[model samples]
Target: MNAATPLPTASARDTTAFLLDVLIPTAAKGPLMRRPRVEALAERLNLDRRAVTRMQKLEEKYPGGPLLLRLPIRKQAVVLLPEHLHAVLAGSPEPFSPASSEKRGALAHFQPRNVLISTGGERTARRALQEQALDTNSPVHRLASSFLPVVYEEADALLASIGDGDGATTDVLDWDLFITSWLRIIRRVIFGDGARDDNQLTDMLARLRKDANWSALKPQRRKTRDEFLRRVQSRINTAAPGSLASVMRGISEQDPAAPRDQVPQWLFAFDTSGTSAFRALALLSAHDEAAKKAREEIDADTTGGRNLPFLRATVLETVRLWPNTPMILRQTTTEVTWDNGTMPAKCGLLIFAPYFHRDGRRLPQADTFDPGIWLQDDVVDVGAREDWGLVPFSAGPASCPGRHLVLLLTSALLARLLQDTSFTLEGASRLSPSRPLPGSLDNFSLRFSPRPR
Candidate 1:
C-alpha cells in the first residue's frame, strides 16, 4: 500500500448508472449497500451525481444496519437537522454516550480488542486514562514542547519545496500531506520514539483514508493494527524515558490495570487529534478569504509576531466548515421517541454536524466563510454561550477534552506560516470535490508562496 498506488477508478457515467439504478433501491430497502453508498445517498439527497459518485469511491465503507435488507446496520434515517445534533450532544451520558459510538466502526473493524473501542467497563477505563493524559490542566507542556518543533519543521519543509519565498502557487492538497506528516510527528512525540518507526500505523491510516469501502479493507487494516500493537508492546518492554509509551509502561509496572488501559489511550489520542488537524487545515485552505483575514488579524495582534486570537478564529472557522468527524453515529440505548419518529433500542442514529452547520436558521449567512462569527467584542471568545452554531470540537461533558490542545496546535502552526509567508490557490478555485487527495477527504489545493521581507 504505497502512496503511489492508484485507487480503483470508475467513469462518472458508470457510477451514476450504478447508483440511480442499483444502489439506491438496495439502500432504500434498508440493506447494507456495498462500496457505493455515497452514490445511493447522492440520489436520495439530489446532490451532484458526479460529485457524489466520486465521494462514494473515496469514502471508507461500513455496515449500515441490523438486517441485510429490512433494517440497516447504520442508516441515514436519523436526524440530520441541527436541533437533533444539539439534543443528542447536550443529552450525553443519559440517553447516549458520545465517545462510545463516535469511532465504533473504526474500532470494531480494525482494533476490536483495543480499549477505547471496547464496550461497558473497559470503555470507561480506557476513556479515564485518556482524560487523565489529555486533561487541560495536566502537564501538556511536554507534549506541546515535543510537538511544536515538528510543526515548524513540517512548515519549513513545505516552504522549502516551493523554492520561491512568496507569490508562488502550491497545491493546498499537498499542504494537507504536510499537515498529515506533522500530525504523525506529533503522534511520535506523544507515543514515544518507537512510534516514529511504526510504519504499520501509518499504512493503516493511509489505506483507511483512500478506501471508502470499510469492509473491503478490514482484513488488511486488522493485520496492520495487530502489527502496531506488537510494536507498542515491544516499546512497553523497553520502557524508554520522556515519552507516552514510557509513561504507559511505567503505569503498567506500578498499577496492574495499566497495560490493558494504555493502548486505547494512545489510539484515541492519535486518531482524533490527527484527524482534527487534517480537517482543520482542509477547511482553512478552502476558504482563502478567511485564511487571509486570519493572517491579517494575526499580523495586527502579534505586533509583527504571533497572535493567539487570529489563530483561534482560524481553527474555529475551519472546524465549523469541516468538522473532523462530520457525523456522529449512535445506537439507541433504549427505545427513544422524538419529534421525527420513534426509534427502537439498538436502532442506528447519525448526527450530521456538517449539514447542521450549514442550516441558515442556526448561523447567519451559514454558507459563507466568516470567522468573525466566532469572535466577540473583537476578541476570540470561543467559550462564550452564543457560539452554539460552532461545534467542531463538539460540546457538553463528552465534548472533546483535547479541544483546547487542538486549538493551540492549529493556531501555532497557522501563526508561524502567516508570519513568515503569504500564499494563494493554484489554478483550482477550491479543492476538487471529485478526486480529493486520499480519495475521500475533500480539501483545497492552494499554491502557497512565502512572503519576502
Candidate 2:
C-alpha cells in the first residue's frame, strides 16, 4: 500500500487557491452545509463572510464533498465528497481494504476487536459464527418471533411506568430503557432459561446499561465481562437436554474454539440490536408525520396481518436518515485515482453515510422525511443502490451480516409500538437541536406523549 502524497512546496497557497476557486463558490446555496473546517479554510483564504457561512453550513451537512482538509498527520485528512466515499467503500478490496486498521478505529468506541471490527482470521471466524446465527432459516429468527410477546410485555411495562403520559414530560432516553429490556427478551429467547438465569451476564449487562459509554470503561468492563463469559461457558459445558444454551454448547463442543469468543458474540448481539432499535424508535417519535404515514401504510397493507411493506420502508428510511454506524472508514491498499484526486495507498478514508443521505443528487428533496422513496417502483433506477448513496446497513463484502435480522427485529418492534400506542409530540414543542448528550452519532432523545385509549 502507498502512503499520502507530501504537501507541495507551495502547499499553503495551493490549499488557499482550492478553497477560493473550488469550495467557496460551489458551496454557496447548496442543498447541504459544509464542516467548520471548510469555513476556517475560507477565512484563511480571505473569503467573504456570506460565502464562508454558506460554505460552512454545506460542509456540516454534506461533509467531505465540497472540500478536503489536509491534516498535519501524514496521509490523513477528511474527504468531504460523495464520489470519494463511493471509491473507498464500493471499490475493490485490493485497492481499498474495508478491514484496514484505520477503518477499525472508527468502530473502536464499540466492538474494539470483534470480527466486524477486525480483519484476517478473527474477522473470518466472527463472520462465520454471525452468519450461522443470522441465517434466514436459523433458529434464532424463530426464537425472536416466539419472543415477540415477551418484547411486547416489556414495552407495556415501560408504558405502564410512564402512566398514560398524564402531561408528564419524560426524556426519550427512557425509551432506551425499553430497548434494553427487549434486548434481554431476545437474550432469553435465544439463549434459553439457563443463559437468561445467569446472574453474571445480567449483572454485566446492567453495568453496561448504567454506564452508557461502556467502551471507555474497557479495563474494568472487560474483566467483568470475561468473568461472566467464563461462567456462561461453564454452564454451557454442563448443559442438559434441548435448550438455546445447549445449541451454543453444542457448537462449542463441535468446535472447541468457539468458547474463546462467545462473549464478544453476546456483546455484539446485545449492543447492536438494542442501540439500533432504540435509535429507530427515537427517530420515529421525532418524525411524527413520517410515523403517522408509516402507521397508516402498515394498517392498509397488513390489515393488521403481518410484514407490511410500509412498515419495512419506515424502518429502512429511519436507518437511512440516522444510521447507527453513520461513518465507515477504509485504508487504501493501492494508489487509486478517484473523484478527481489520486489517493496514495495507506491513506485513511472516512465515508460518512449520514451526510450522504442528505445529498440531493441521491434522493429527491433528500432532507425531507419521506419513507415512500424506498417504495418507489424505480428506486434502483433512481440510483438508490448506486455506490454509497443508500447504505444504511453498509455495502460490499464486509457489509453488516445481520442486515436481515436487524430489519426483522426493528420492524417487529415498530409494528408493535404503532399497534399499541397513539403518539404525539409533547408540550406542542419541538426539541432543541443543540443538546449534546446524544452526541454527534445520532440525536435520539425526543419527548412524546402517549394518548390513553
Candidate 3:
C-alpha cells in the first residue's frame, strides 16, 4: 500500500526516504513522520509567500500523493489538505498533543510553560487559566474596548508620520512607524497604560525581532528574559483595573499553578496581527471600490452605533491570504485516527491553513477579494468563517483562545484607519515582478494622507 503513495520528494537518500523504508504508511503515500522538521518548515513558510505556491504545485502534480508529506525528518508531516487539518486540529488533545516540540523549544527561553507550549497536566491547567484570563466577560471586553482609543491615536500618528510630497515616496515598512505603534497597542493591551514607559518590555520585544541564531548569540538572552518576566510578574497588580494584565493576575490567584508571566504570551500572539494589518494596507490601497465601501460601512457604524461588518470582512480576507501562522505543528502522544487513516503514537502533524483557505474548488472566489463572499443570509455579515474549511484562527478544542478578541481588534483598527486616511501604493512596490503575490510584502510601500473632508 505504501509503494503506491508518493510524497513531495523522491530522493532515495533523503530522510523522507528513510522514514518510508522504516515506518508504516498512514493509509496511502500520505505524509511520513520521521524526526522533526517543524522549525525548518516554519522558516520556509515565514520567509516567503512563493513557498506556498510551490507546495500547492506539488499537491497538484501528484493527484494520488499523500495529503501529508515528510520533509527531511520523521517528527513532522505537513498536512496539505483541509481534511488532514480537521484530523489533527479537530481531534482530542489526548491523541494530538497541543504542545508541539518546535513551539516548546523555540519559546523555551522566553516562556517555559506558555499555554501554547505546555503539555501534560500543567498544559491543561495553563490552558484553562489562559482562557479565564482572556474571558469575553465585561472585564475582558472592556480591556479590548479600552484599546480603541490607542488604536485611534496610533492610526492618526501613523498617518501624520507618512510625510509629505517626497517623504511619501519612502517605504511604508522602512519607517517602522506601524510596527512600533502596533507593538505599543499589544503592550497596552496586555500590560495596561502604565506599561507605556517600560523600557524593559520594549527591549524584550526588540529581541523577538531577530532569528534564533541571533538570539543564541546574545550571551544575556536567558538572563534578560528571566529578568523581564520576573519584573512583569511582580507588577501585574500595578496594571490598570480593566487591562489584560490585571485579568491574568486575577486568574493566577485562583489557580496557584498559573504562571504570572502569561501576559507575555498574549503579547507575542498578536505579533502576526501587525503583518496582517500591513497587508490590509497594501490590499485596500489597491482596491479602491472595496476601500470606499469599507469606509462607507465604517461611517454607517459611527452613525447607527452598529459594528462595521465590511471592515471585518476585509480583515478576514487578508487572513485568508496570509494566516497568522501558515503551518501549525502538533505532536501525537497517542495514535490519532482520521478518515481512512491512523497515525501511530508520537507522530508529528502539521496543519497548513494557507493552502486550505485558498483552495479554489472548496471556497467561492478563492483568489478573488470579494469580502461579500463572507456575507451570509443573516442579520449582520462579516466575511470570515470559523468552519473546519477556513481555519485562520483554526478550529476545535485547542484552537486559539484569542480568536474573538483578535477579530474584534483587527476589524476595529482597520476601520478606524481607513475612515481617517487614504493610501496609495508606491510605484516600485506596485510594479515589482514578484512571482506570487503582486507586491512583495517585505518592500510594500504605502503613502498615507488625510482624506478629503
lDDT of each: 0.49, 0.50, 0.58
Off by over 4 Å in 3: 1-50, 57-73, 136-140, 161-175, 208-220, 251-257, 303-306, 338-341, 378-388, 428-436, 443-453
- Runs of candidate 1 with Cα error greater than 4 angstroms are 1-77, 98-105, 113-116, 136-142, 164-180, 192-200, 208-223, 235-246, 253-293, 296-307, 339-341, 377-389, 431-441, 444-446, 451-453
* Top of the candidates by TM-score: 3
TM-score of each: 0.68, 0.67, 0.78
Give the lowest summed-lDDT range of ten residues in model 3: 26-35
lDDT of 2 by residue, 301-403 (tens): 5333234555556666666754555446666677665433456667765555655665555455454545676676612111235544677766665666666
Estimate the TM-score for candidate 2. Answer: 0.67
Error of 1 at 311 (Å): 1.4
Model 3 compared with the native: what TM-score? Answer: 0.78
- Angstrom error of the Cα, residue 209, model 1: value is 6.7
lDDT of candidate 1 over 1-453, digit per residue (tens): 343332232344644553454344333322111223453353345443233332333222311111111222432233433455566667664465543443454444444444434456655665566566555433233456656666566656656655443643453435455545565565566565556556565555445433323433334455655555565567566644555455565465334234633554444445445444544544455566666676676667533222366657766765665455545655557655554234455555555455455554445555455667777776665442324435776665456656666666667766666666655435433343232222123332333434432
Candidate 1 vs candidate 3: the lDDT winner is: 3
How many pairs in model 3 have backbone atoms within 3 A of each other, for residues 3 or more apart or on separate chains, i.e. clashes? Answer: 10
Q: lDDT-based ranking, best first?
A: 3, 2, 1
